[model samples]
Target: MYFLTSTLNLSVIMFLASLSIPTSGLDCYSCSVCRQPFSKKTTDTMTGCTVCSISQTWVDGKRVTTTRGCDKSCSPADLRIKGNGLVKTCCKTDLCNGNTNLRWFKSVVLFSGLIVFKLTHI
Candidate 1:
């Protein structure tokens, strides 16, 4: 009986410890391209999260594209560009300034807890 209790306690502790582990993922609060900002209104079904639009520009007469997001909020300066040209800008405002990281962190914690619970049961 003592051995069984010890094993159960250990399992419970391990499961709880796993709950304390930190997991991280990219979340987009706001995105901008060419000085245009997009809110986190758009969601990626696969990730079930909001993402920024891909910024595209013509460089040396060729189309160049880049992706932004994975953070809470982004600005035009964060995009970082050099040179001069008439660039197209696009943006969303629905989810601007949202706490994307916090949301992601909470989700990760919840998922970890679920996993730990399952493991403890096993």
Candidate 2:
């Protein structure tokens, strides 16, 4: 029982600790006219960014351009311009804004804890 309790405590501590770790900075891609989904062609790599962002401009309901870069502050929003549109996307992970599917980090940590717990019990 003591061993079980210790193991459970360790698992909880590990999960909590992972959640509290502070990132010194985030890395992101910086580019003008970045390709959709993701592109290998980035103009530069940005470090120490608070957020990563992608902006898309559409003309007559068709996407015409994409831009990717690091941002100090960003909020996802859409704006319309005379039947055209602009969309801005924001994410907290490295290079996350360039992709259509944002990667979730918390879920991975929880899954890892569950795996560790199962392996320890077995």
lDDT, model 1:
0.41
**In terms of TM-score, how similar is model 1 to the real structure?**
0.24
- The lDDT, on a scale of 0 to 1, for candidate 2 is 0.69
**Which 10-residue window in model 2 sums to the lowest lDDT?**
100-109
- Number of clashing residue pairs, candidate 1: 5
Angstrom error at residue 1, model 2: 22
The TM-scores, one per candidate, come to 0.24, 0.58
- Identify the leading candidate in terms of TM-score: 2
> lDDT of all the models against the reference?
0.41, 0.69
List, residue by residue over 1-122, the lDDT tens digit for candidate 2.
Answer: 98997788788767656543428777788888766656556457788888788787889887788888888887666685875998777766666655644233334435655866875686
